[model samples]
Target chain A: MANQPISEPAQKFGERVRARRHELGLSQEQLADKAGLHWTFVGQVERGRRNISLHNLLKLATGLEIDPAELVRGLRRPTG
Target chain B: MANQPISEPAQKFGERVRARRHELGLSQEQLADKAGLHWTFVGQVERGRRNISLHNLLKLATGLEIDPAELVRGLRRPTG
Candidate 1:
């Protein structure tokens, strides 16, 4: 599971996190501290290399000062 | 990490998923099949016993036939 390829949803989620971090003028280290996560993990998440858990997802949203829902606002399920 | 006690967000998320699944008239087995997860895993998720990954979260939303954001629509970051 750790080595699974990144999915489109993961990529988009990473982009949203990166954009939000930029909007807040925070560095990856700063966001990591605020989110109670490691800087390396934050970097991984921003690069879409981690399939983030719900707990960390909420922490990231808190660190970003946004509603948790906002992080996933525009994502849609892929159609078959 | 695997043994962490269930948090409020996880509990709430589970409740939302259960409600939606019931609304859709789907059993845990049915929902699991739709979401491409194991039935036991789906049961754990509905019971808030798993710290679900973002990938599976999206899958669950798709199985529930709702927008991914809808699963998190009213969730807010807890204030410190």
Candidate 2:
């Protein structure tokens, strides 16, 4: 997650990646290979340190076997 | 475009948004209102300076009268 941008949205995105990865029981390295991303990037993304591209986001959705919308679930407005 | 993320991927996404908006004859402010987003965010997104969330993506797709995949058309592997 070194030197990656950590915006509020990006951080939430990373959190979702970790949560989903845990639910799927896949390691970061495994997810990276399937998504065709560098391991470091994947790590950063999971840690909410980097923002991902739409292509990589699609790849992650495909790799996670989840709907594209699922990745954005993190973006929902938090209930007060 | 404030101090937003400016990756190669973000650039293409912005370009796609601009192209689609032109094709639809809509402005960034109009699209923002329809999509229930901030005008600045819309401008930033159209400039590829921000990575959008899935919810916003859905709203954009809906407001633009296009399919979800259409928004992702820019993410396809370039066959150069």
* DockQ of each two-chain model: 0.52, 0.14
lDDT (10s digit) by residue, model 2, range B1-80: 45654665566777777888889999888888877778788888887777665556756766676664556643532222
Tens-place lDDT per residue, model 1, A1-80, is 66442877777888899999999999999999998889999988888888888888888988999877888766654344
In every candidate, what fraction of the native interface contacts is reproduced? 0.62, 0.05
Model 2 CA deviation exceeding 4 Å by range: A1-29, A32-80, B1-5, B74-80
The CA lDDT of each predicted structure is: 0.82, 0.69
Prediction 2 global C-alpha lDDT: 0.69
Model 1, residue B13: distance off in Å is 0.5
Question: What is the RMSD of candidate 2?
Answer: 7.1
For candidate 1, what is the total of clashing residue pairs?
Answer: 0
Query: Model 1, stretches more than 4 Å misplaced?
Result: A1-5, A76-80, B1-5, B74-80
Assess candidate 2 and give its TM-score to the true structure: 0.53
- The interface RMSD value for candidate 2 stands at 5.9
> What are the interface RMSDs of all the models?
2.3, 5.9
Docking class of 2: incorrect
